[model samples]
Target: MDGYVMRLNQFISHNAKYSRREADILIEQGRVNIEKTKANTKSVLLEGQRVFIDGKYVKPKDEELYTVIVYHKPKGELVSKKDDRGRRVVYDTLGGKYMHFVPIGRLDFASEGVLLLTDNKKVAQSLMESDLEREYIIKINGKITEEMIRAMNEGIHIENASTGAHQKSKIYSMTFAPFIRYEIGKNDIHFSKLKVTIMEGKNRELRRFFAHFKADVMDLRRIRYGWINLNALPVGKIRFLNKDEYKQLHQFMGKIGKIDSFISKNNI
Candidate 1:
């Protein structure tokens, strides 16, 4: 307990072994240990303690660099590490260079655009929790009307499947619809394109929100996340965040001086 004592799940995740949720699973399965004793999800590790996962030693990762990359994720690739059906994932397409990088948030398999990958779990967690904005370029199968936009902005109630009684099932509902700042683009009679920005990142939220309006999203691409934008970077390629980009990202996360400390510690 000399330097930094971190929670077991955080330590496991920070080592680039697994996500915090996955670490909890490993701990609950009795696969994690410290000093030959079974570890719990809430267990804390001292500065110099060694951790073993599945009887294999877990090495500490160098957190000094805190590398972040902006990846132009093309459609058809999952943001997950491995897929049950063996479909191509972002890692599969990235090869071995970013094996330890974790996606900040996710873009569904069918959606494409700017994706942030990082080795630092704290930074990733911070960004996910922050009120950072994301911009998307979407194409829907029908003309968007002012009423639809107003309803979306005012919020809509959607059925909550998770909250229902057995048998006769008294189903409940939840209000969704984040404020959508949008600009419509001229398109063919069958479809219309929109550039929309939202602050929250709910699971398939944009698609579900549009579905409420009876507007099917034919194409969806996220062009921006926080201060990071998918400028001219070619799809399927990744580039490290430049100095300004890193600074701006940290600023958005309210983590000023973090980049400087990382650079100084790693001498990068």
Candidate 2:
């Protein structure tokens, strides 16, 4: 109790009641208290301190061992807990006590492949914040020209429809190497397969990036995230990361600050 202290919002987040942002709002609204005193966003709680939100006691949960799982998400299922349209979701395919686990990022309903899930928010945050690369194999419906490949690598600007104004958003701003792995040639039809790698995970970035080139994505599947590869995992199956895998992930995160080559190898 005397040796440990944590920020009020972090304490609330660790309790799994609300996110840090939500905790801040509750604190600002005068709904949170520590030791019978009103708590602020920056207030620090000593170990064993009692916390109450809206007049209800909230005990800090004992630290649980972090659990990380690699899920082969199937297409047509969402990466959400529930869908309003009653469509099947990724969570529906999962069994046991995985209700608390959160997907690190997400694969869209139409796209599928390797997805990382974890019960520990810190682990999720760390891996996401790191400059780890993700690889995808995409089938595109168009003749991919060398000029288009050059433009994609240099970066392209697309209209930001969500911004209301005629603002433009930049994509592929980082170093991206795309290789044409397969191609189906016909007199009047063209279909090409590409293996693209990127470090950022913007929303539907790959699809949008191809759309800028007037190329339609027929299918998209993520094959790798960091050192973890989908490999031979069957669709809709989840595998818990082993101790060595977990250790390597953390080690990879540490080395991202020094060298990128460290991550290219040791992806378990």
Candidate 3:
């Protein structure tokens, strides 16, 4: 029970599919159940419980060797498991079989950035749960004020509510305060091109932040996340983590558990 586990509802949220409340509605309609019991909407899930949703057996995804891929997703590509409209997908560019992985976090279809895709559910869950930092290179038209920085760093009240109850739209982790670190000279005027960092991976949070200030995001890109950086990966291209980089990621997670030991012993 010490390892990765989540309630039936939380499992849905973690999958990036739907919210917990929505999961509950599915449960109430007898669409989901834990073991053989009708799911208690608020019941806590212990490790190693067999679950089912809509007659499909639920299992935490498992793939070979905790693979992590850094995808330089270009704009207009969807980050979904499958695109209904048959538009270009990130996986389509990956080519061949990749063991059906899921993205660790998301970037809007219109935004371009570094996105993490992996088949290791635990690794994905830990990255979302841990206090690891994320860095972004944001380009916006107009000036950024001190108060705006303060609000971005301290957390912004997203114009609309999110899946969770926290009114302080968790677009950022407490580890980072929003600040503009750089400004490039454009036609003798100091324009804003800021490098910001945070941990929370809220959907469309970047666009929402600038929206609150009436500023338009000319371009937004996630350059780094925790120990990994998308230094030279070309847009729409991806590469798997070498053994050393994979080990380094485990170390950066603060020596959490036997995942490190397992990786070391197996050389994965």
Q: Which candidate is the best by lDDT?
A: 1
lDDT of each: 0.79, 0.73, 0.68
- Write one digit per residue (lDDT tens) for candidate 3, span 27-64: 88888877888787876677777778877876665433
Tell me how many residue pairs clash in candidate 2.
Answer: 1
Model 1 quality (TM-score):
0.75
In angstroms, the error of model 3 at 223 is 0.6
**Cα-based RMSD of the predictions, in order?**
6.9, 7.1, 8.1
* Candidate number achieving the greatest TM-score relative to the actual structure: 1
List runs of model 3 lying over 4 Å from the truth. Answer: 1-64, 158-191, 252-254, 258-268
Report the lDDT tens digits of candidate 1 across residue range 1-268. 5666799887887785576888899999999999788899779988788999988888887654588999999999999877788899998888766867888998988889999988887688778866788999999887887766776578667785222112333534546655658787855569989898888755677776676667777888889898888999999988989899887765655553566578899999
Give per-residue CA lDDT, model 2, range 34-147, as digits (tens). 978889877998867889999888865444457789999989998876677899988788853675576888888889999998876766777877667888888888777766
Question: What clash pairs does model 2 have?
Answer: 227-267
Sequence-dependent TM-score of model 2: 0.67
lDDT of 2 at 50: 88
Q: How do the candidates rank by lDDT, highest first? A: 1, 2, 3
Q: Which stretches of candidate 2 lie over 4 Å from their true place?
A: 1-47, 50-64, 160-188, 253-268
